[model samples]
Target: MLRRLVLTAAASVAALSAAPVAAHADTAADLGARAGDRLTVTVTDAGEGQDGTFDLECRPTGGSHPDPAGACATLDQVPWGKDPFAPVAPDAMCTMQYGGPATAHITGTWHGRHVDASFKRTDGCEISRWDSLVPVLPTTAGA
Candidate 1:
């Protein structure tokens, strides 16, 4: 009886430790893209624990509409201190940018984890609104 008890206890401990691994469950795979006058990105944590280092990208959808390079150039030079288009914090979980027809990628750190997401720009000049919610996984070791 004592031996059985010990074995049961050990088994319980092992199961508890592994529980966390399996606890990371997601019901569905969420992937979407949008673009309009406003560039917006929403990241949902889909891991056992809170995630971190989320990065989002805004890429011109349907293959660079016009000059992809120029669009990016405009975004890069756009002053964050100006109206509407401003530089975001180096560590913002959610972020938005203003520019032309181009996708925006935003990334940040949360709960000691790193995540990445992207969006495609298509319409608007302040009227274009790209909205999407991406799944964020836990940052693995050395990520």
Candidate 2:
């Protein structure tokens, strides 16, 4: 009986471990609403000097712009020597993180694509906010 119970428990654990994890992605409407919102997101880590650019573009979807009123916020010229693992709060304008004495947090958003950037602070791991974007071209209300 003990052997059977142990085998059952082991089988259950194995089944659970073999289960596939589900992942979710954001949509265009969500991204449009986030326009102009401030976020602190990690761009990329090239393992060199901190230098990168975040480009925001609006590609017509379904024969029209997605968000016509909001302009996609452009965040370029990001330079960093090391990763900033901190939870930088997001706003409706820019991606601004607090002072060096920063705290860590895991925060990300779901827009068309899940664009989340995280860091590793000495205290803990951190996540940047989703940058706001002001759509240069917006979609028509009817179209």
Candidate 3:
């Protein structure tokens, strides 16, 4: 009876180990789907024909943003451990150059976390931060 019980326990363990584990696997697509990533981008004082509020939905990628696909792709390029919306360190040195009057606010959920970030072009660091978001904020390439 002990031998039979041991064999049964071993068989159970084997069956459990053999079961598919894909259900619990957290792939990028799976995480995005579960995260419900969405954002509302508001731009102000940018320039003529540049100020507006837009909606952005990623993963499935749909929204009122002009370049939803590009925006989503750009956002996806941010590394896993980095925060795309992170602000420049206060102690960091930055150029005094002004990019423009452009300013933006992005608010929503990303990667299952809340995001409330602001962008501006008042200085070099701030401009770079704003530009990094590219189409997510709005193209300021030539302007």
Candidate maximizing TM-score: 3
Q: Model 2 reaches what TM-score against the true structure? A: 0.19
Residue 109 of model 3, lDDT score? 86
Instruction: Judging by lDDT, tell me the better candidate of 1 and 2.
Output: 1
Largest lDDT belongs to which candidate?
3
Give the per-residue lDDT of model 1 (tens digit) for 1-143: 99999999999999999877665532111112222112223322323332323223334422212233443344435455332232333464443443333344444321122334343332222212222121212221211
| TM-scores of the models, in the order given | 0.23, 0.19, 0.76
Candidate 3: segments with Cα more than 4 A from true spot: 1-35
Better structure of 2 and 3 per TM-score: 3
User: Residue 131 in candidate 1 has what lDDT?
Assistant: 25
Question: How well does candidate 1 match the true structure in TM-score terms?
Answer: 0.23
lDDT string, candidate 2, 4-23, tens digits: 99999999998777654321
Judged by whole-model lDDT over C-alpha atoms, candidate 1 comes out at 0.34
How many backbone clashes can be found in candidate 3? 0
Q: Candidate 3, which ten residues in sequence have the lowest lDDT sum? A: 20-29
Candidate 3 matches the true fold with a TM-score of 0.76
